[model samples]
Target: MSTYKAPLADIRFALFDVLQAETLFSRLGRSEATRDVIDAVLEEGARFNETVLAPLNRIGDEIGCSYDKATGAVTTPPGFREAYAQYVEGGWAGLTAPERFGGQGLPHALGTALKEMIDAANLAWGNFPLLSHGATEALLQHGEPWQQEVFLKPLVDGRWTGTMCLTEPHCGTDLGLLRTRAAPAEDGSYAVSGTKIFITAGEHDLTDNIVHLVLARLPDAPTGSRGISMFIVPKLRVDRDGNVGGANGVRCGAIEHKMGIHGSSTCVLNLDDAQGWLIGQPHKGLAAMFTMMNTARLAVGLQGLGLSDRAYQNALRYARERLQMRSLSGPKFPDRPADPIIVHPDVRRMLLTCKALIEGGRLLGYHASSLLDVIEHGGDDDERAQADALLGFLTPIVKACLTEWGVECTYHALQCFGGHGYIAEHGMEQLARDARITTLYEGTTGIQALDLVGRKIMQLQGAGLKAFLELIEGFCSEHEGNPDLAEFVAPLRDKAGEWQRMTQEIGGRAMADPEEIGAASVDYLFYSGYVALAYWWARSVAAAQTSSQPDAFKDAKLQTARFYYARILPRTLAHKAAIDSGAAPLMALQADRFDA
Candidate 1:
């Protein structure tokens, strides 16, 4: 199997050259996040992920997580605990967390680069700490002072891990249908009773405690979503002084048997009146949970990007070495028995497809992460609000597009290896399997589509779309006169205009029939994603041209940008056609008559 290597060069280019994250940090008053510091963090992160986590990926897959039914304990694959200990010792758990809570106080954008490397090296292991970010966000935003005081530090210091327990047996997307119950205790805490399914890292021996942010309905609370309340239910109870004690009512009923990410424990968590504390306002759990969900969604997008890059790297390497039939043009390597498959046009198409999507998707995901810095530290209220708006709008797009593309890119990567790719030894199929979960979890592509069209576009008046379009216009206007950028600028500008018009049209149609939102949502999201990448690809080429980098790097950027525009961006045309078709054909098929 090909070894995992962190693409530090591309990561640097995306963060510094294209995004100008240093300037962003300076403007946002993140004085400690200097260029030198960021570089050091990235370098160390690369080393840790490549050396520590990457080696365990296949082992994690092969051994998986072992469950002890008697004790309700889940043991992670070998080397996982030691690697996690090293990760904690390196102070990576709280890299982007607030310093006041025992964190490094760095920018989220920098943390995103580190996360991509971690996911690429070992996606299953990365799942262990994934929800801790979201849980930290929830606590930071809504936890009471004492709760934060008690929980935040431990989570930041990596002494304990966290989980978001929102899904149940009956409901996955619709939280209103949940049946969890939370009853008040005399000591001012609550008793949370619920069975949360698909809980990642719910019960693990890696940490002394497992912090669960659970959704349960309280007594006298209203029915449906409004009745739901969030609670901090830990596997081991903790005192106000932050002392870990005996077990709470939380237990791992069973660990799921899955298709991929076998190393990551997906648990059926049974909280039988678990000792808990309420977070935020009464019956306002879902609103507070969004804090964690949004964070997780963005992280999930990074998971997709990481897997795509890993798959692409291996595919590219294989294509250059794997000798096959002679090139149709002629034998490029006549001295050898057969020319390398890289000489073939179709193979190049698949490889280029992965390249264009992975690179462009990198900029897209990183840019979204930078918005968090703005939201957290922008100089003015209006600036922060605008950043928040834009972040909200782009979240679903980033989550859905990157993950769906991950599946596509991995497929193309495996296809490049021919029959050998399908075998487990090559590890290509594992990536293919792993990539599938990113789209399905953290709100499926269809769910993200509905969120994009129904809520962000229609209900919120497309504030995020408007912010993104302004960015496109500003870039196009700034580069319109640059002859070097003329090819990309014109097309990007046109797409920006079409994006705005498309939003307006969807909004208008949704006003007449709500089903139009559902029908156009998935297609509209893909359309929006393609246009977003178009803007980023153009920016990448512009950055590469102006940088002090070598000619080869700049040339590759330009070539990839050209390929994206010529081949990948045209996908928006089909999506636009689907959107223009409206909801008539979809609803025309009756429920019972569908089988006919």
Candidate 2:
């Protein structure tokens, strides 16, 4: 597999230039959190991911993880524990965590950027702590004071790890059918009894304890998601003094052997009368759990960003190095036995394809993070509400499209490597394999699609969509005539037009036929992806123009923006057409039709 390097330059550029993320934090009144501080901290995180955690990415993939049934212990692939130590020791463990709990209290934008770095270096390994970060977020928002004091401190300090336990052997996407039960004790605690399957980082030896945020129905509560209550069930209970207590009721029945992310330790967790405590109010667990799920969904989108970067880097390096037939016009490298593969237009197209997604997607990913920072830290109530609404609307888009496109980015980037890409040692295959989970977990693309089409669009009687279009329209009007970015600006306006039409069509069709919306959902997702990326590209183009830099940076910026508009953005057409195609063809045949 190809060795990984942290893209420190591009990351810094995204922060300081395109998103002006540091400036956003500054405008929010956190003046102490300057660009210089953010840059230095991000640089350190890069090295940790590059030199510390990245090596184990392939190591774990090759050796895989181990589960010792006799001792009921799990071991990560070699070097993982040590790398985790370095990551925590570097003080990156608490980037976005609350300062009272020992975190640096950095903005969520920085946390999102840190996420991108780690995922690119080592996706499987990156997942371990990222999951913990999301768990901490959920607890901070919903957990009671005692629960926070008991668990959040250790988690923020990286003294322990965390996991989200929602899916079970019998149910996943539909939580209405979950069988787990949470019964309260007179002593003010609860007992959780049920089986949770496909739990990532569920049980591991890297930490003294694993704090699980689980969803289970209360005995006398209402049915479906409404009946569920969130709980804090650790692998091994911790005493009042924070010492490790006896084993909790939760135990790992077995770790799943999966296609990719073999080292992640997906588990089937059996909670047999497990001692637990409710994090939120009775029958309000789904609302609380969404705190973590939404955060994870956005992080999953960045995973796609990381995976795309990995694939692009490998394929770009190979294109420049690998030699083949001479140029059509003339040999670029006359002395060489064969021309470098980059000379091929189709190869250029593939390289450009990955670049378009990664670079543009990075802007949207980081922009959303900054919006989150504004939501948390901005001084004005109006600004915070605006940030909250905008972030909510885009989160699913960031989650669904970036991940879906990210996999395609890897697939195409890997394809450019030809036969060499298929080999394990080349690293192209690993990039593809590792990115596969970004779409499946947190919520599937289908679920996210339903969310965007069903929930986000209709929010506040189209207030969310109106607010978003206003922002995009404002940008297009201001930058329309600029010679430097006219090419990039025009397509963005065009895409906004496309989105308006698609939204109306989906809305009209779903009103007449409900299932029509479900069938067209994924396409709606891609259409939104196209529009989001277009907005970011316009912003990025503006960034490139405002910078008084050498033409190399300027040229590359405009070229990438053009590529995104001209090539990648056009896919929305096919997606829209497919959405308009409706569910008729897809659901036409019953199961018995195949048998016949």
Candidate 3:
């Protein structure tokens, strides 16, 4: 069986040392997010997850969620409901929500650490509360005051969970093709009818009521996506006075037998004339639903990060204890019958790759969360705008790259165990299976790639990219004279320059041929992600050197950063080459000629 202990030290280092989140929170007037408070939260969060949720991970995976066909209800694995109850009782569900909504009113950046712990501890269990954060965002931004009082408060305080009912039987990514209909009622409510598939946490026993943020179309609306509207449809009807009643035409038709995260119910939700209330204006649902989708995209990225960390921890432990062949050069432990597999160069390479990606990726994800704080609370409008732009640029990259890397890291970790990793008992295969879903859900990597190149980069004129480039340039300029950092700073500066040039080249080509965007998107995203991590790794090395940590810790950071630069950073070159190849090769293959 696998064990999980939250990586609190690395999390704190990324939050305070590398990102200086405490200073940023103070500057943003978030007085409640003091270091002591944040530290205590992290401690309690670690304790709860490690003690409560971690023990249930294997059982959840083994037993999974059971669905009652007659009742259309889901019974989660034995310990899942209890764990969620404890999570709510501990006030963790509202850790970063508004104080007025019975929340603790903490910073989103601080919550990122706790979220990571929960996911790492039990990702299946984590899925239940995950969509609630997204629902809270959608409601706070678009829900009416009465709706907020009825729906958003419970979502925040963890009395009820939330679901984003977006995908339908026929439509996964194409919202314009959806057939869900919302008919207006005389009593100011709407009757929603649709069958939504792959709805996570749609019907769970963890909460009494499930608030579903559903997308549908009104009768007189325009065609396609512009005709869409969002509605709040609860499993059980709730009046404006906040009283819960009987079932409101919402029921679970079926549950998908998935490849991973089985304890988290992936439901087929059938809303048959369910009583619903409009959220935001009609015919503009996609925009409003994006509020929830964007939040889920980032949270999904954390899912990848958490899984990667857990996989790495177990792989490292296995490598240190499992006896294998002696070192290639000579045996360091002559007394032992065989040296540990950690003595092998190839094993070390795998471990180093995991370390580099997990640590650097932590900074990547945390920095994006800090940007949310600035956008919400920053005093200066210009600063807030910059943070928002930077966040927009980083979101797709963070979501796509971290998830793709998660798949890679899990593969490496499983490989470290040799034959044992393939079995069910060792639990490496479970982590690998769970990690697979992150890249596909919220948005596929391909969708994220297109979003980055087409929407964020070309349409927004790469405002986020420009902001990020400035940070790299400024960091390089500040550290150019420091001999200790010259090795990292020089290459980082070079990659930043290359990143800007590549973006311009892609932009120029996209103007002549629009298909170029689709062709260059995935490769361009990978290229940009590598360069971005290069910048963070350099900063991490510098922070480690100057911090009050032990010499061994500093040396480990230095060595790992070197390994990343030498072995991993060169991956950007391949992506750049693919981006430079243009769209010709891909387009040359005629669709009908493939089978010939």
Candidate 4:
């Protein structure tokens, strides 16, 4: 594995130059998040990951986590707990959490950048804090006053860990089919009885307690999803004074044996009449859980971004160093026996693909986080509402596309290694293995696609898409006459128009037959994602053209923008075709006749 280094330069460029997050932060009243502070945090975070976490990436994969069945406890791979302690002591767990709850209250955009570094350094170790951050978001949004006071502080303080227990052995995607039940007790608490499988960071020895945000059904609740309710179920119950008490009725039945992220414990949590309290209103669990899920989905997208960048970095280094064959034209290194593989166009193609995706995807991820800052702290309600809508639409796209690209980029990175990539010792194989799960968890790519095409576009009448399209159209119009950017501006305008038309067509078809939504969903998602990245790429090109930065930096941005449009953006054509195919081909075959 190549030594992981935080891409602070790109992160800074995205924040200060491309996204202008500093301006957004200032406008949002995040006064403490000055450039100095953000930079310092990023630099320190870089050091932490480089010196501490990066070394553990391979170790985590090799040792994995050990589960003690007798005690129902999970011991993370060696050095995992110590690294976490350093992480907590560094005040990283609450980097963007609420100030009232002991967090530094920095902008989430900064946190998102830091998170990418940590994830790239050690993805499995990153999960522990990742879950806790998601849990904190849920509680901050929906927890009761006392619940926040009792649980939120510990979580924010990094004294306690957290987990989201949603999937069960029987029900994975369909929460309506969940069998968990929560019965109210005389003391206003509830007994949560269910078995939640595939719970990340569910059982770990890193923290004093694990606060599980559980989803279950209450008595007299409606059937299916409407019946579900959210609960605060802790592994070790805390008293009113915020002191850890004896074990609640929660235990780890077993940890899963997984292909990747071996350091992060995926547990089978048995909540046998566990004492719990409702976080949000009764029977509105899905809505409350979404508070956390949305946060998680975006973070998961960054996981994809992180892994892809890491793979690219290592592969690029290897390609430039590994001597393979003479260039078709001539040997770039006349003194050497053979030129480095980087001299090959195919290798350049793979490297450029990774670079384009990571840089462009970084913009998308940071832009989403910037919108989050607007939603949380922008003064104008209308702007906040618009930002909220756009963020919702981008969330699924960012999650699904980035993750899918993670898989693709890793494959390219591994291929660059030749047969050496297949060997375990090279670390490319681990990157490939770990990238597989990003698309699977935090809702699968298919689920995110359905949500995008079905809920965001159809049910919401494309409010999110409309807001985003308007921005794209406005940008294209602003730069339409500029000769230098006319190439990008013209194509972006056409695609934005096409995207709007496609959405309207899909909406009309779905109105006639709801199945049309499902049929066109995945393709619609990819189309939207590609177009979204195109807009960001255009913005990047504009930024590069006008900037005072070194020509090297500006040239890289312009070249990548060209590559994205020339090579990657055309992917929208195939997706649009697939979307136009409609439900006929998809639903033609019967369930039992799939084999035919």
Over the stretch 1-596, how does candidate 1's per-residue lDDT look in tens digits?
74689999999999999999988899888889999999999899999998999999999999999999999999999999999999999999999999999999999999999999999999999999999999999999999999999999989999999999999999999999999898899988888887899999998878989899999899988988889889999899987777789999999999999999999999999989899989998899998799999999999999999999999999999999999999998999999999999999999999999999999999999999999999989889999999999999999999999999999999999999999999997899999999999998889999999999888988899999899999999999999899999999999999998888888888888889999999999999999999999999999999998887899999999999999999999999999999999999999999999889
Error of 3 at 536 (Å): 0.7
Model 4, stretches more than 4 Å misplaced? none
How accurate locally, in lDDT, is each candidate?
0.94, 0.84, 0.93, 0.91
Steric collisions counted per model = 0, 1, 0, 0
**Residue pairs with clashing backbones, model 1:** none
Q: All candidates' TM-scores? A: 0.99, 0.97, 0.99, 0.98
Off by over 4 Å in 3: none
**Model 3 over residues 1-596: C-alpha lDDT tens digits?**
88899998888889988999889988889888889999999999999989999999999999999999999989999989999989999999999999998888899999999988988999999999999999999999998899888887889989999999999989999999999999999989999998999999999899889999999999998888889999999989987888899999999999999999989999999999999989999898887799899899999999999999999999999999999989989997899999999999999999999999999999999999989999999888999999999999999999999999999999999999999999988899999999999999999999999999998999999999999999999999999999999999999998888888999999999899999999999998888888888989999999997787778888989999999999999999999999999999899999999999
Relative to the true structure, candidate 3 reaches a TM of 0.99
Cα lDDT, model 1, residue 559: 96
Model 3 error, position 222 (Å):
1.0
For candidate 1, the TM-score is 0.99
User: For residues 1-596, what per-residue lDDT tens digits would candidate 4 score against the true structure?
Assistant: 65788998888888888888778888788889999999999999999999999999999999999989899989999999999999989999889998899999988899999999998999999999898988998888888888899999989989999899999998998999998899999878899998999999999989878899999999889999989999999998766566777999999999999999999999999999998989889998988789889999999999999999999999999999999989999989999999999999999999999999999999999889888889999899999999999999999999999999999999999999999999988899999999999999999999999999888988788899999989998888888888989989998999999999988998889889999989999998999888988999899889887676789999999998899999999999899889889999999899999887
Which runs of model 1 end up more than 4 angstroms from their true locations?
none
Deviation (Å) of 277 in candidate 4:
1.0
| Highest lDDT model number | 1
